[model samples]
Target: MDNLTHSLVGALIGQTGLKRKTGLNIPALIIGANLPDVDAACFFWLEGVEHLGFRRGITHGPPAWLLLPLVLAGMLWGFDRWQAKRGKRPEGRVPVHFGWLYLLGFIACLTHPALDWLNVYGIRLLEPFSSQWFYGDTLFIIDVWLWGLMGFATWWSLRQEKRGETWRKTGRQALALALVYIGVNGAISTYVASSAQAANPQATQVIASPLPVTSWDREVLLKVDYGYWAHVESSARQDLARPNKISVSPCRLSTATAGANSQLDAFLFWSRALIAERAEDGSVILRDARFYDPRARDRFSLALPDVECEPLAPPSP
Candidate 1:
């Protein structure tokens, strides 16, 4: 999920009466919601596809979940005292309760990874303990519909608060509706994927990637043999349409050469459906079948050693 979605979720959680828990509870919620993304700082030191392997790992795991909120709570507690020392504390501010602040921070931080796991990009939920990647494949990375739904509810809640009426109910209703929407989409993806696999016994895997702005639509990819076959699916349709084969490199990576390159190793670690193709210059190009695009061929690709690439063995049917 995008940062805006994460931030909006945090704010909505805060609007559900949690903001009254402490003087800086709202900030704690908002910042904690995005704290797991601090791993994005890897771009400053790591190059190329290396960040892909590092992101959504340790920082999003259990250890960070437990420690990050504690750190955030302590900072908020210090800030409150600092304000008091300067005689600048807001008169209307509620007393800062370290316990409540920490709870709010923990609640918000937990929402971050939950949202992140709902897309095709995937996340490492048990990172440090196990580097397994989990994918929800239920929603697009950025859903404008979610933005509208949660964004409007948040705004309406704030408006109701200003009017001194019950506002938490509005937030709760919005949260419920959002959950229903997500559940429905998850069901749709599951149905499409299962249907695809059942129809093609030779398929090793099937991915139902949600498309942006169309909750009922999905781009289905079936892994077979040496590559993948893709087609669009709509809930309104009665049957799975014919799928076109995706062009991919038939070259295989040299284990000895790839092991020596950190960049190639990182790319391999993060690529779920890796494909290797021989470039015009004889160098091998590696790409993931999940996100391969001709217009942006180099986006998630890396070049392997210049040695003659080996041919891939035909996959078992």
Candidate 2:
């Protein structure tokens, strides 16, 4: 999920009466919600597709979940003391409770991974312990509907707060609605996956990727022996009658070249449904079936240069 969604979720959580727990409870919630994304810094040091292999890994795992909130609590405690020393602490602020801060931080931080897991981009829930990627295939990476739902609720809650009216109820309602929306989408994905599998028994894997604008629409990708099959499906239509075949001969690189190119290796490690094709220039163009876009050629693609490409035989039908 996008950082905006994460921040909004954190704020919503705070608005549900958790902000009253401590002086910096809101800040802790908001910051902790985005803390797992600190791994994004890998972009500065890692080039090309290397960040893909590193991101949503160790940071989104159990160890960081346990330790990050503690670190945040300590920082908030230090900041509170610093403010007191400078006599700049807010006069109306509630007493800062370290325990409450840690607990709130933990709660907010947990939402980050949970939301992240709902998209096809995938998350490493048990990273470091296991490098396996998990996908929810429920929602788009950035859903306008979610933005509207949570955004309105958060804004309305704050408005109610300013007017000294009941505010927590709005947040709670929004949270419930969001969960219901997620559940509906999950069911849709599950149905689509089952339909695809039933339609094509040869499919080894299937992904029901949610579209950006239409909540009911999904771009389904199925991995088969030859290559992949892709098509759009909606809640109104569950049939997989015809799908565009993305047929490409598998290009295998020599062990030496594969091990030497860090960028190629990283892309291979991250790509769940990988497809390799030999370009006209003899370079190997690597792509993932889930994110490949023909119009935008370079987005989710990596080209390996000066590598010997051997086209493998397609599996017998």
Candidate 3:
């Protein structure tokens, strides 16, 4: 999820907690919740250092979670002590019930990684030790539904609270809607993925990509069981057009197909099922199709020669 989405969720949780109980340090809690994303700052100031490699490393690892409570506690102590020394009411021990602050921070930061996982670029949540990249391939990196839910919840809660309305009415309703949307989105993604997989049981590696294409209904990423062959493609199946064009791998399947069966047939099946335009070269092209730009093939050539430019031209029509 994006910053605004994270912030809205954090604020909503904060508001709900405050509404239910007394003594939460809402501001500090909210700040701590968003601290993990401080990594985003590196993208601008640190350049290649930020997300280029370290996006979901130690910061998102399981071990880092243990230190959060301690870190929050120490931060709380220091801030209060400073306030007291300055002759002010030291924010008074931050309502003990607010210790749930740890959970708040955890969930908030967790959302960051979870959302990133939805993107094509993988997130190494279990880094160093386990660099195996994992992707949800479910939701889009930033969903408009998430944004609207979080924003509406925060707004509705604040406004209703101002009018002395019940928090349960506005706040809970918003959270419920968000959860429902996530659920529905997840179910649809899973069904599509399962269908792609069943379409080709022999595929060595299957990457189901619903994003990175336009007007294009589905894009499936596949790795065949043959010659280390792979592909990133999109294809079409239309209701009105009988026997419309489709491929085992279609987005860039411009490659001639005489020897198409050379690559593992399994991966090729999914590729053809999902492809629209085969690559000019039969080789797999690993590139982000997010922009759906008509000229993406040309652009991909610049960065991914191995996957994009290698010409394993399909044998023949």
Q: In lDDT terms, how accurate is model 3?
A: 0.51
lDDT (10s digit) by residue, model 2, range 101-166: 999999999999999999998999998899899999999999999999999999999999999999
Candidate ordering by lDDT (highest first): 2, 1, 3
CA shift of 112, model 2, Å: 0.6
Point out where model 1 deviates above 4 Å.
227-241, 294-296, 305-307, 312-317
* Total backbone collisions for each predicted model: 1, 0, 29
Worst 10 residues of 2 by lDDT: 227-236
Per-candidate TM equals: 0.93, 0.93, 0.65
What are the runs in model 3 whose C-alpha is more than 4 Å off?
A: 18-24, 41-50, 87-100, 200-204, 210-218, 224-317
Q: What is the lDDT of residue 115 in candidate 2?
A: 96
RMSD of each: 2.2, 2.2, 8.3
Better of 2 and 3 by TM-score: 2
- Candidate 2: TM-score? 0.93
- For candidate 2, list the clashing residue pairs, or say none: none
Off by over 4 Å in 2: 233-239, 247-257, 294-297, 312-317
